[model samples]
Target: MRRALAVLEQVRDHAAAEGLSLTELADTLGLSKSTVLRLAQPLLDTGLLSRDRRHGHFRLGPGALALGQAYLAGIDLRTAAAEEAHRLMREAGGTVHLCVPDAPHIVYIDKVENETAVRMASRIGSRAPMYCTAVGKAMLAWLPEDVFAQVVDAGLPTVTTRTLTDPGLLRTELARIRNRGYSVDDRENEPEVRCVAAPIFDHNDVVVGALSVSGLTSRVTAARVRELGPAVAAAALRVSRTLGATR
Candidate 1:
């Protein structure tokens, strides 16, 4: 069973347009061609794998797509993210937000507040620009190039004095966010607010959402932002793992 699943995973990982040949699969799985064939037989029978008669390459069959669809149907982002957001709020002593991208903006899906923390103006279902918010930048840093181009083309309006309206600077900041594994708002979204955020990924290693710790500038200072960055990133990683992100 383990070997069969490994074979399936290898095929999934190498799922190019032409798929993989028997020799390639044998080398990748470190098994004899006959052994690899034996392992793949059951998968082929179950419709999870298919071999091209002409090219002799193996590819994922319709069964794989069905399994993927079922898995996506069962996942609820807000439910999967709740515990980590609450834990971050408790430990970080700030408001926590779970946001998902909506092209030029990000929509807040869940918010958890520490009782003693200052209340933020943001609420569930509210939208914020992608250029100035930490949660938005966290996701933008990991999303595709076409998505980034779309955000830039939409215009980076200045939300506050600290907001990065220049495309070049914003691009630099996104690169930094990718390198550091997190992003900081630095009072860019709102004059009195600061936030630290990290991206959340789904099973296919796609960026699906973000988690952030938001607080007043007085409480979440420069030093505090630095302190919270890695912690926020670790908390977000836990959420990503729950969603089955391998990385």
Candidate 2:
């Protein structure tokens, strides 16, 4: 494991610095050029690694993009959860989102909004603060301890009157999310917007992202949140399992 990751990391880091040819890279890694060539072949096929203009020098390739798409398609946790999100939307008439924490912020990778044709402020590729939304909270609950510490070190920026800016309180909130298996955004990220999010775990039982449903604060009242929470959580759990998460 160490050797494989090490080689991938080294190739990525060194490619830009040394601009090595196959022979030079093999010499640098203390491997035969043929071995290096063979090792690089798979990534080359996947476009994660590529050869230089001469096909002798190596560089990261477009195949990496293919792998990214493949990873998303193969492990398509968000896509799987999207169905549940859409179902929730259909059942309750709102917008749903699938997001992953990118630290400092979260990015929506998929969504299913109502059919009303009204323009929404969020969708796939949109970014939101981790300290504000339900998806952010869901994603944050599973963040590595050291990363959480870093988030705590950086003062949380308040986006609205409902935003949780205190690190201590936010930490407490995260704890509750872990226990409850879901999160809520009560007009925190944006005034008048309420969101509910559930964590989606991967095969390793690690949170890879969150599934959320959002609507006008008036629409997702406290009572309505309670009503829809279980459905949303179940959907997220189902998607997690489809992604190979067992727990």
Candidate 3:
């Protein structure tokens, strides 16, 4: 069963449009052509894989699209992220935010506040720029190159003295965020406010949102940001898994 699913995944990844030859699938899967055929037989029988008549190459069939549609239909981003966001607020002792990308901006969909922590100005449904805020940067780091370029082209306005207003600098910062698995807003979006955030992905392995912990700079100091980064990242990963992200 696993081998059959692997075959489908490989075809989906490498041959969705153009399709792949049996030999190619065999080489990619490190299996002989006969063995690849044996594993793929069930998928073909179930209408998950089809051979192009003209090219005789394998491609994802309509059954795959049906499965994808069903999976997406069952997923609700806010509900999927709620528990993890609350747990992050409790564990990190700060306000937690769930935000989804909105082109040059991100919209806060949920905010979990620690009762004892200082209340943040951000409210659910509020919008923030993608260049300066931790949650925005977290989503941007994993988004496609064209989307990132569009945000840069739109503008990188200064929200605070620490905001990365320069395009080149923001690009470098995004690379760092990808390397560390989280992003930091060091008083960039709001004065005396600091935040650490990580990207959340869906079953398609596409970044759909971000999870963040925000607090006053005095309490969430530079050292605290470093300490909280990985924990925030782990929390976001759990949310992603609940959304059916394989990665």
Error of 2 at 53 (Å): 54
The digit string of per-residue lDDT tens for model 3 on 169-234 reads 999999999999999999999999999999999988899999999999889999999999999999
Off by over 4 Å in 2: 1-73, 117-119
Estimate the TM-score for candidate 3: 0.74
TM per prediction: 0.74, 0.68, 0.74
Model 3 off-target regions past 4 Å? 1-72
For candidate 1, lDDT tens digit of each residue in 1-247? 9999988998898876679999999998899999999999999998899999998899998889888778767878898899999999999999999999998999999999988877999989999999899999999999999998999999988888999999899899999999999999998989999999999999899999999999998999899999999999999999888887889
Alpha carbon deviation, residue 94, candidate 1 (Å): 0.3
Which residue pairs in model 3 clash with each other?
none
* Candidate 1 Cα RMSD after full superposition onto the native fold (Å): 4.2
Q: lDDT by residue for model 2 over 1-247, one digit each (tens)? A: 3444544656777755645577777777788867777777776766777666755566667765565457656756655776677787788788888888888788989878787734459968978788788988888898788768766676688889888998889999999988988999989888888888898888678888988888887778999988767777888898887786778
Better of 2 and 3 by lDDT: 3
Clashes of 2: 6
lDDT of candidates 1 onward, in order: 0.93, 0.79, 0.91
If both were scored by TM-score, which would come out higher, candidate 2 or candidate 3? 3
Q: What lDDT would candidate 1 get against the real structure?
A: 0.93
